[model samples]
Target: MTWTDDDPGQGEPPAILGLAKLRTARAQEIRRAQDTLTTASGDAGVGWQAQSQTAFAAEVQKTAGDVELLAVGMEKQAAVLTQYAGQLSQLKDRQRILEQRRASAKSSLARANAMMPGGLFSEPTPAPFVLAGEEDSTAEAKAEEEARQRAAAESKIAAAQADLRAIESEWDALVADRRRVDQSCSTALEAADILGAVSSFSGSAVSAASPGDLLDRLSVLSAIDLQVLLAAHPELAEKLQAASTQDVATWWNALDAEHQQTFIVGLPNIIGSLNGVSALGRVAANRINAANRLEAIERTLADWKRQAAQPGSFTNATSQISALEDEIKYLRGAVSEPPTVQLYLYDKDADRIIEMIGTPSPETKRVVTYTPGTLANLDGFYSGDTQSIADWLHKRDEDGMVAFVVKDGRYPQNPLTEANDQQYARGIAQNLADFEEVAFTDPLLEGRQSVAIGHSWGVANITVSEALGAHYDKVVSLSGAGAPADWTPSPTTEYRDFSYDDILQFAQDIRVGEHGAVWSGRNPREVGFAHEDYYDAPLTWKSFPGNGLVNPLLAAAGGIESHNLAASTAPGNLTLLNDMRDFINEAGAPR
Candidate 1:
């Protein structure tokens, strides 16, 4: 393989050089063809590799496009689900309102039925008559007829009561259904983030994450959601703020169980445009506004219900507001100015009347006190002569200074509602406090009598009656309540000396032979106390109609009937000393 640089390979022959030249020329041609072939092969391999790579890239891009389309479809479906859920929730709310109305009607119907007559009696049987008077068959026949009449009445009462009970049961079932629907709506609202605020700038990331991931990221949505909620449902939002730690824990627990899986599996791709500009914000705002307006309208409708129940309220309001200017002479029928009642404050400290009616009572005596439950207003005093048993014994004597300790306490016409009960309770409590403040400031009432008389639910005022330490004397309830179900004692009984029969009987005894004191005249029913036994048992049988006497005015007063009776018995301003003294002694005395 060693070759000389020069010298013609050491000895070149002319003929041989010619032969080698030919051979070399042929080899050079062969080598050129091989090089050309190699280059062509290399170029073809490079082109094939590039084409394969292009095809692979197309396949990857197609796969990505399919995935994006699937994500879009999922998002659309989620939106539709949200909309349908909202619609269902609204429907449920409407159903609840309808059910509430039905329930109210049913309750009224049941109450009416319970009040019907005969249901209050026990089954009638033949009676034993006196031997001397029973000799005649005619007398026995008359007795049999009376018994038949009584039985008929009893049957009618029973039928009415049964109907009422059936209606009430149906009403109860409907109420239960209403509650279920309300709960379902609440659940749906929670999932839809009804109260949650959507931020235009940074919307929920839940839309983007899988359902599981969304649950993990819900905390991220909490702050904005809360803001949105406050703007949407102010009342509910306020409640949310006041919710206890336990409530929040419960809410979170329930929420986690309900939507955790859905959020995680479908959130991310679903959250494509997670900004406020999206449908979530708009839908949330619209739904919240609708709900709020619906609630407000419902409240308005409830107000109308009161008007419907008592046409008198509407009538009074109309007359008062219109000043009776549009009424014809006949319609205005002998209109007379109602005397204005004034609350006089007798300052025990100054020994003078400090303020007149429309003013706070004067804090005088050693125990300054204001007694309610009677015709409270000195001006608007009740003139009727149906006196409470207390009044018969307690009103002033013949001598002006020797008058009994009786005072006319005004009670305006006011209906009893849940809201009314709460308001009245608060008013009475505050008024009691006011009395204490006066006592402290004045020297006269230092050791005087401090007492408050609440007639009906006004008995609730007893809750704050003893604000004056031991200064209070006696709290007498005329016709007080028993327990609603009678499984236990009356709720307000522990707070006062409860009595109905005693007061009624006492009232009867005091007016036995007095002038303007006839039992029939004193009772709105015009039935003498001697005959009350015949009514009491039947009236007490169930809960409605002839069983319970009806006096619209008394119902409005909502206090013990005796207090109003006292005011009615007294013709003018008179002392209630006799009544108060008697009641104090006989608070628990036997009938």
Candidate 2:
């Protein structure tokens, strides 16, 4: 079923407000249980104490339920956030690479221009040498001298031509690089911005006063929160239900089927809210407009190229070309991309996945282990998301295997809940250990080489396993959590850290156990997304901003904005998948 949140009638609603309320409810239940337990323990009657114990048991179950729901919400939210961040990171990287290439081209162009015109290699005019009383040289001697001079001049001219040609080659290379970089950077940055904006919206939901407030902010919901909110405010839900449904459906039909499915599963609130649908439509329209602008500029460049090919057309085309480039660059910066979601597939069966990903070359045996941070889902799969990476690797690497392990082995049903930060970290570790055990046990994996790629929580999982004595070759963590003081990596551990958000619980938790020791002591490659930041020049969410729980409006805005950010660089995410495949091929390790 296509679920959408683009209905205008639904109004702006918080994406994760319902889950937050669920967490709050669990908290309340826990508090109530404690109170009853305390009172019962102080009572004289055993029967009353037993009753209290039973009640506590029931409360605990409810608490667990709440926790599960909340965890689901957190997981979903985390998935959305990571997807956006990862895509943005990719966009930033591509843009930087492209810009660097472009800059080199510009430098080469400058040199070439100087050499070609009246600059560096310009031919110098010779002045006649007239000695005061010197007789004129004989005609025959003068002619011979003139011939030699002519030869020398010709040689100098040839040399200059060669130099100019070399510079032109450099210029051409640079131009190509610049074009690639520009296009890639533009697309990626736009995607990142949109997703970032959505994330900003959701991030604000952390402090929503109630689920209703949050739902109102999301401006879309036909499920859970809206249902709950409707239960609370029957009149409002009833009044808006019919219009919201139609509006959401209409909006859903406008999007691609895949997107439609994603919207429903990930953004239930939007499906029920007409306003959310409208906002989403507006965002989509903006993305389309940006695409159109890019296309138009591309056409203009093509026309310029055609005109430049005509005799004397360079003079006319040059200035226009420069102007067009400037305009494209600006438009690229301005355009926003659609939101993207990451999908992480934990492939317990690597060989099959490997074959599924790439062309068949040989019967290869390999292992792939994936670990991801919070908020993962099947719904939010995108180009640069971990799953996309895996897909790329599968297609590109003919012989490699792949696998994934979710943070805490917990894919919460809801995307809103205070995470059991410790358990989540510990669980991923357990997952890795289990994989190792399985690898050793399986004939296919026995003696087969493997690599582990972890991001955020996944990094913790791999580190924890290594601490507990698991083995793997080349562990890469993308934007991993915990500092060197938190996770120590030695011979078996390799750390690749992405510089992103500040690590909070990860640092504290890794400080707890011997695993904590491992967490605290690893050197990671800290690559900054500054490349993208410099290019896209990310801005904070303007419409909504605050602790998500405290502000419904911000939370709602964050969700949409983050989605856009993730989507913008989604193409690069797809490229990453190819990189993964290439990595496998280069390693020549069987999957």
Which model scores highest in TM-score? 2
**Candidate 1 local lDDT, residue 109:** 50
lDDT of 2 by residue, 1-591 (tens): 111222111211233345445545654665565556556545546555676667666655544543444334434444443444344345445545545665665565555444442457434444456577543554455566556555655555566566556655655554454455444533442242223222323322424334334434434432233333333344443333334333443444455645543344443332422232432332333344445657977997988788788886534667678766764654464353422211111221231111112211124355566655445542232213535444545544445453432332444333223123444455456655644654333333345566676654455557667666677766655544433234445544333333222232223245444454323423244321111121121322322434344465454454334333321335523433333344444543322
* Runs of candidate 1 exceeding 4 Å displacement: 1-318, 321-342, 345-416, 419-424, 465-471, 480-498, 501-580, 585-591
Best by lDDT: 2
* Model 2 TM-score (2 dp): 0.29
Cα RMSD, model 2: 33.1
Q: For candidate 1, write residues 18-79 as lDDT tens digits.
A: 54355445445545554454454445454467666656555444334433333333343344
| Window of ten residues with lowest summed lDDT in model 2 | 528-537
Cα displacement (Å) at residue 123, model 1 = 99
Q: Residue 435 of candidate 1: its Cα lDDT?
A: 41
Count of backbone clashes, every candidate in sequence: 63, 125
